[model samples]
Target: MSALLSLRSVSVNFGRGEKALRVVDGVSFDIDVGGTLGLVGESGSGKSVTSLAVLRLIPERLGWSTRGRIEFEGQNLLDLPADKMPEIRGRDIAMIFQEPMSSLNPVMTIGSQISEALFLHGWPNRAKRHARVVEMLRLVGIPDPEGRLGAYPHQFSGGMRQRVMIAMALACSPKLLIADEATTALDVTIQAQVLELMKKIRSDTGTAILMISHDLGVIADICDRVVVMYSGRVVEVADIRSLLQRPAHPYTRGLLESVPRKGQERERLYQVPGSVPMAGSVRQGCPFRARCSVAVDKCAVKMPPMFRFAEDQRAACWVSAEQSNAPVIEDLK
Candidate 1:
């Protein structure tokens, strides 16, 4: 099966030499047609950087650089000309950025901003573009779409602004959607609404989604597949159900264990001990070695290669990778 989007051992570094900080370290994953792949991790896990690299939004002139390939529909995005990117961006792949307040222009009306993508993507009919904008607003669950056409970013609530951002992203009905913490600002009700809207978009348009978020619940809510990132590296990748039921990587298990479960009681929430390594400090072994409870001396001495557990799931842990072939704690449980 072909992927709608693919990132192959993608590494992102800022600056050069000793000063260089590897923010995104050798990440690999893919979003198949109409599939939603969630990137879940703590802040600074390089999820955003990976997304930015895919969109070619990383500031190279400011010293950011990437190694490996980011492909969309088999085309290498890194090799595309700068002028060609704008076309692919809105028309083929759109992004709902992390920060609505910063991503949306305060000076532009929501309708115009939403309509602009349509127009730029070659929808020249004025009436048709306006109609599409209204439809998008309504699809995103905004009431009185016609009346709110002229409203500016400042006029809408944060949640409403997020909906507008979503509206703009979906205006072109692209093949892929990169949503970074997409519903963070929305109330639970609106969040559910937005998630449903995304699911509908996937079903109706077959748009693959790269959903980046910290919320496991949100990931479980909307994503079919999951990619667990830790300190700029992909520690695990699996189907959402299998991942929740049987996480192979210790970091992934730690994250899931830390989430507040319905029946689980605790005096203190489980915490992955220690902090993530500074991006500047190059580690020879697993990035999570410092915090992993199950980590062995090998974890500190040698970097674990990404070992495949299944066709769709892989993990970068020697013990877990080895355990996949043998009956152990996770399998016994």
Candidate 2:
């Protein structure tokens, strides 16, 4: 399958000159058409920032800037005129932000909020837009869709609000859906329901999904391919099965081990030693070296290029690159 969205050497920085901080550095990946890709990492790993950059939503007034190519359907989004972005943002690519409460307008009725997207994207007939809004609410499992149309955001529970957000995002049938930490605020049962809803939506609409989360379990539940990130850089990329069974980068391994297993309820869960370093703090070398157990001298001197371990697996680690039986691909630097 061809790529639906491709990010090449995409870097996002905050501030200017000597004090600039690189929050997302040299990240490259692809989401194939109708496929699900997960961007997994801990907080401060730049997962959210990367997704925001895709939509050109970063606040430029605050000294934010993004570099590198973001291509959708063979068009470089970075090169597109600023005024042209709004047209593509809602109709072609829609995002489900992390917090539904903050993302939604508390004062607006649910129906009006959803219909706004349809209206902005050319659903001119008021009757048709209302019908579509009702259909979307029903599609997302909301009951009494028509009756609830006048309900304010404060009237709905957290899960229902999130479902409304999804309804609004999918109202126009976007080709790509960027869900950033969509399930984080929900309880376990609600989280599972949301994931299942997303899966059903993808299957029914054939929309490619970019699932971003700090939970590997969530990623494992939905993603076909996983991109593991540490600090501001991507450390590993692989098929879900390969990454879970044999993680190449130490950071990836640590993330997997930290997840509590089904039968290990009595045992204390393993934790990755130390916290993620602040972005841009490590000017040279691997950002994970301080936390990695297997770091060598080379790890401290410079960052390792991505090494190929299989047809679909790659990792950026000196040990993995040097020790792998498969030929290393050092051109990713």
Candidate 3:
């Protein structure tokens, strides 16, 4: 399948001059048409920032600047005129933010919030917009959808609120959905329901999804491909099966081992030593070298380029590269 969304060497920086921080460093990946790709990493790994950069949502006044290419459906989003972005944001690409309560307007009825996107995207007929809102609510499994149209956001439960957010996002039938920690605030049951809802939406609409989360379990449940990031840079990319079976990057391995297993309730979960380094703190070499058990001298001298282990798998780790005997495909540094 062709790429629905492609990010090439995308970098996001905050502040300027000597004090500037490179929060998202030269990250590159692709989401195939109608495919699900998961961006998995810790909280400070720049997952959220990268998603925001794609939509040009970064606050320029706050000294945030984005570089590199973000291509969606053959158009480079970075090169698009600023005024043209709003035209594409909801119609072509929509985002489900982490917090539904904060994202949804408390004062406005759920119906109005869902209809807002449709109206902005040129669905000027009020009756049609209301119908679309009801349709979307029903599609997301909201019971008594027509009756709840007038309900405020606070009137709904957390899962219901998230479903409303999803309904609103999909109201315009966007080609790509960027869900950043979409299920993080929900309980396991609700998270599973939301994931299933997303899968159903994709199956029903053929919409490609970019699922961003720190939980590999969530990623495993929903993503076909996984991109493992560390300290703002992508360290590994592989099919979900390959990644779960044999993670190429140390960071990826660490993340998998840290997850609690079904029968390991009594066992202490393995932990990746040390927290993620502050953004831009690792000025040279592999950002994960300090915590990596297998770090070599080469890891300290310079960052390793992505080594192709297979057609669908790549890792930016010297040890993995050496062991696999794969040629360097791309230098991210």
Candidate 4:
């Protein structure tokens, strides 16, 4: 199957002089048409930055560039002309950001905000834009689209605001949707509802999705494939079942172990030791070696190459070639 979106060894950096920093380093992945690929990592792992680079949404002063190509719909996005980017943004790709309150205009009516996407993208008629606004709201499951259209952002609840954001993002029926921590602010129930809605939208429209989140459970539930990120790079990539059942990277294992399970009794939750190295402080080795229990002299001395587990699964770890022999915590204790 051909990829609808592909990132080949992409790198994104920021700052200048002594402050120069590389936030995303040599990361690559591909998402197939109508497939969902989850980018999972702890905070500050460059997942969001990677997504922003794909959308050309990174801050201008930050000085972001990709040494590699971001191919979407058979075109290299990095080489797309500035004038053409806007057409690609709303028509070919869309994003649902983490914060609705900040992303949504404070004074604009919910319906009008969605309509702006249509207008900017050359909808060309007030009647068609109005119809699209209402259709999109209904598509995202907002209640009473006609009445909601007149209501401002402040009038809607957090979940409703997010729905409006989703409605706006889908207003153009983009082929790929990039969701950056889209559920973080919502309560669990609402998060589940939004995710279900996204699944429904995907089924109905055949839209490919790239979902970025720090929550492993969210990814497990919604994504077909998963990519584990660590310190600005991809550490593991696998289908959902294999990833959750038999993660290969030590960082991936740590993430799985860190999540609390039902009826489990332990003194404290397992935590990945040490902080993510500051953007420029990363060394020439496995980025997680500072926290990996399985780290050896080789792990600390050089970055591991990606080892294939199967056709659809791969991980960046020397141990990925063999079953991990590292001692478990129970054995250590």
Candidate 5:
């Protein structure tokens, strides 16, 4: 089976010459058909930038160049003509952004907003579009969608707006959905509902998802494969079960430990120590060396490679890979 999406050595750089900032560097991963791949990292880790790059949504006008392949269903989207993106973007691959209100048109009626995609995609006949919109609203658990059609975004609750966004994104039945922090703004109960909704959509439609967020719990709950990134590079990738049970990289473990567990009693939650470095701050060695508990002399001098630690797990840490019997890889310049 072909992968729904693939990112091969993808890097995103902004600005020109000495002012260039590599926001995403040498990152690679894939999502099999109907698979959920999570990109977990703190703020400025480039998770969101990676997602935008996948969608060709990055502001290249500000002087940016994305290096490497971004393949979707065997087509390198990076090479696809810009004018041809309409057939691919919402029709083949869609995205639900972080904030619902910001993504939605506040002045437009919910009904009109949802119907816009159907119309743009050549779904003529207002009656059929109305029916589809209502069906979509109902599918996403909206109450009396037909009656609520004319309501503006502010009228609905936060969760409701998110559901509306999901409905709009899935309305086209895109084969891939890039959900960038899809549930970060909702309350716990609503977040659970939205997460469950996304899972159901994947199961029902066979739509692959690239879930990006800093929430380990959310990643463990929804993703089949997880990618750990730090300061713009992919440091680890593993199956969700192995990642949650036996994380290979110190960064991955630090993230899991930092989250507040359900029944654990502690004076304070564990922290990874230090914040995510700003763009272009760390230019050598392992990006996490400054904070890694197991860092060695080599970690500060040579960049670590993604060494396979298990059949399906890989990490980019000198000490962790060495401990796992993964051969130390020299500078991969």
Candidate 6:
């Protein structure tokens, strides 16, 4: 099957001069139609920026792709004319941000907001557009679509606002949806509901999803495949089951260990030692070298190429190929 979205060596850098930062570095992955790919990492791992770059939503003056290609549906989206990019964005690709409160307009009525896409895409008449808006709301499982139309974003709770965002994103039935921490702000119960709704949408509409989140549990529930990012690079990529069962990279392993699980009782949660290094402070060799308990002299001197574990699984770590020799430490100091 052809990939709905593919990023070949995509990189996004911001600013220039002494303070310049490379937020996303040489990352590459693909999402097939009707497939869900979860991007998992700590904050500042470049997941959000990478998604923004793919959507051509990176800030104009502050950021640009220093290199690589963003191909969507066999076309290089990066090569498209600027004016025409917006047409592709709303119709063929859509995004649900982390914060719906800030992402939605406070001044606009929810109906007007959802209808905007249909209007822009030329849904024919105002009556048709109104009907489309109500249909979208219903499709997203919102109650009382007729009454909710006049409501402002602030009138709805956080979960309701997020539902509006999802309804808007799917108004035109986009082929690929980029959900950047879509459920992060909601309560656990609501988060589960939203996630289930997304899964239902994907299955029913056959829309591909690039779901970005730091929550492994969420990913395990929804994603068919997973990509683990560390300091702007992909540390590991595999089938969801494979990754959860046997993560190869030390960073990936660290992430799994950090999460609480059923039947597992521990006083304190495990955390990867040291924080993600500041973008500009990154030096030569492996970006995770400083935090990796398994790092060796070679790990500090040379960056590892992505080594294949299976046809679909890969990890950028020298030790993964020789797990017996991989370091086994109780904790990092």
Candidates' C-alpha lDDT: 0.86, 0.93, 0.94, 0.86, 0.89, 0.87
Q: What TM-score, to 2 decimals, does candidate 2 have?
A: 0.98
Residue 4 alpha-carbon offset, candidate 1, angstroms: 1.0
lDDT of 1 by residue, 179-268 (tens): 999988678887887888888888887888989999999999899999998888888889998899888899989999889878877898
- Model 5: per-residue Cα lDDT over 194-304, one tens digit each: 999999998888889989989989998999999998999999999998898999899999999998988999999999888888855788888898888989999989888
TM-scores for all candidates? 0.94, 0.98, 0.98, 0.94, 0.96, 0.95
Model 6's C-alpha root-mean-square deviation from the true structure amounts to 4.6
lDDT tens per residue, model 4, 140-205: 888899988999998888888899999999999999999999999999899999999999999999
With a 3 Å backbone cut-off (N, CA, C), the pairs that clash in candidate 5 are none
RMSD of each: 3.7, 1.1, 1.2, 5.1, 1.8, 4.6
Assess candidate 1 and give its lDDT: 0.86
In model 2, which residue pairs have backbone atoms overlapping below 3 Å? Answer: none
What count of clashes does model 5 give?
Answer: 0
Model 2 local distance difference test score: 0.93
Q: Candidate 1: where are CA atoms >4 Å away?
A: 326-333
Rate residue 82 of model 3 by lDDT.
Answer: 93
Q: TM-score: which is higher, 1 or 2?
A: 2
Error of 6 at 28 (Å): 0.6
lDDT value, candidate 4, whole model: 0.86
The predicted structure with the larger TM-score, 2 or 4, is: 2
Q: Could you tell me which 10 consecutive residues in candidate 1 have the lowest summed lDDT?
A: 324-333
lDDT of 6 at 201: 96
